[model samples]
Target: MRGAIAAMVLTFLAGSAAAQDLQARLNDYPTEARADYVFGCMAVNGQGRDVLRKCSCSIDVIASLLPYEKYVEAETVLSMQQVGGERMSIFRTAAPAKALVADLRRAQAEAEILCF
Candidate 1:
C-alpha cells in the first residue's frame, strides 16, 4: 500500500538523519586533542608509520564512542590526579571523578580492541 511505502520512506529518512548527526558530532572532536592522543598512543605502542595509522584509528574510534565534552572532563580528572596536594585529593578520591575516568578508560579499551 502507499501508506506502508510512505512509512518505510519516513523511517529511512529518520535513520539517515540520525547517522549524519552522529557523524557531525564525531567530526567536532578537536584536532589538538586527537593529535595528543595519537602521540601518547604512539609512545606506548611504538614510533613508526604503522603506529601512526593505528593511533589515528584509535582516536577515530574514541571520538565515535565519546562526546568531546565528556572526553575533556575525563582527561581533566586524569591530569589532576597526577598532582600532589590536599586540594588534589578530590580528583583522586571523588566518585564522580572516578566515574568519568572510568568511562574514558572503557572507551579507550574498546578502541584498542577494535583498532589495535
Candidate 2:
C-alpha cells in the first residue's frame, strides 16, 4: 500500500511537470533559474580555448524546456556561441525565460492539484 501510494505520488508529480505551458513558465522563470543554467553550461562546457567545443547540457534539456521551433533557434544560438566562444554564449542564447515560466507555472499548478 505504501509503495503504491509513493509510486502514484511520483507519477503524478511527473505528469504535472509535463502539463506546464512553455510560455508561462518562461514568463515566470526566476533569475536563479537562468543563473543556474549559465553556471551549469560553464561547468559542462568548461573554460578554455580548444579546437573542438563541448556543451554543458544535452538536447533533451532544450526539448524539455522549449517548443520545436524554439529548440531549433536555441541550437542555432548555441552553435554560433560555440564558434565564437563557449563561455560567451550558451545560456545567454538559451530559450527565453518567459516561455519556460509558462511551462513551469502550468506544471506547478498540476502538481499542486495532484499533491492534495
Candidate 3:
C-alpha cells in the first residue's frame, strides 16, 4: 500500500540522517590522531594488512565512544602517569586524572570488544 511505502521511505530517511549525524561526530576525531591510534594498535597486535583493518576498526569504535577533547585529556594524563617523578605524582594520584584515564580505558576496552 502507499501508506506502507511512505512509512518505509520515512524510516529510510531517518536512518540516513542518523548515520550522517554519527559520521559528523566521528569527524571530530582528527585524522592524525586516528592514524596514530591505529598505528599503535597495529604494532601491538602484530603488523599486517589484516591488522590494519582491525586497528582501523578499533579507532573508529573509540571515536564513536569519545569526544576528541576528552580523549586527548585522558591520553595526556595516562602518558604523564608513566613518568616517574614527584612532580608527575599529580597525574598518577589525582582523582580527576584517574577518572579521565579510566574513561578512556573503558572506551578502549569497549572498542576492543567490538572491533578486535
Question: Candidate 2 residues 44-77, lDDT tens each?
Answer: 5566533012221332233345555553444455
Highest TM-score: give the candidate number. 1
lDDT of each: 0.94, 0.48, 0.91
Instruction: Supply the global lDDT for candidate 1.
Output: 0.94
Question: For residues 4-59, could you state the per-residue lDDT of candidate 3 as single tens digits?
Answer: 99999999999999999988998899889999998888879999998899899988
**lDDT score, residue 63, model 3?**
83
Error of 3 at 46 (Å): 0.8
Off by over 4 Å in 2: 1-22, 48-116
Residues 1-116, model 1: lDDT tens digits: 99999999999999999999988999878899999999999999999999999999999998988899999999999999999999999999999999999999999999989888
**Pick by lDDT: which candidate is best?**
1
lDDT rank order: 1, 3, 2
TM-score of each: 0.87, 0.23, 0.81
Could you tell which candidate, 1 or 3, scores higher by lDDT?
A: 1
Give the C-alpha lDDT of model 3. Answer: 0.91
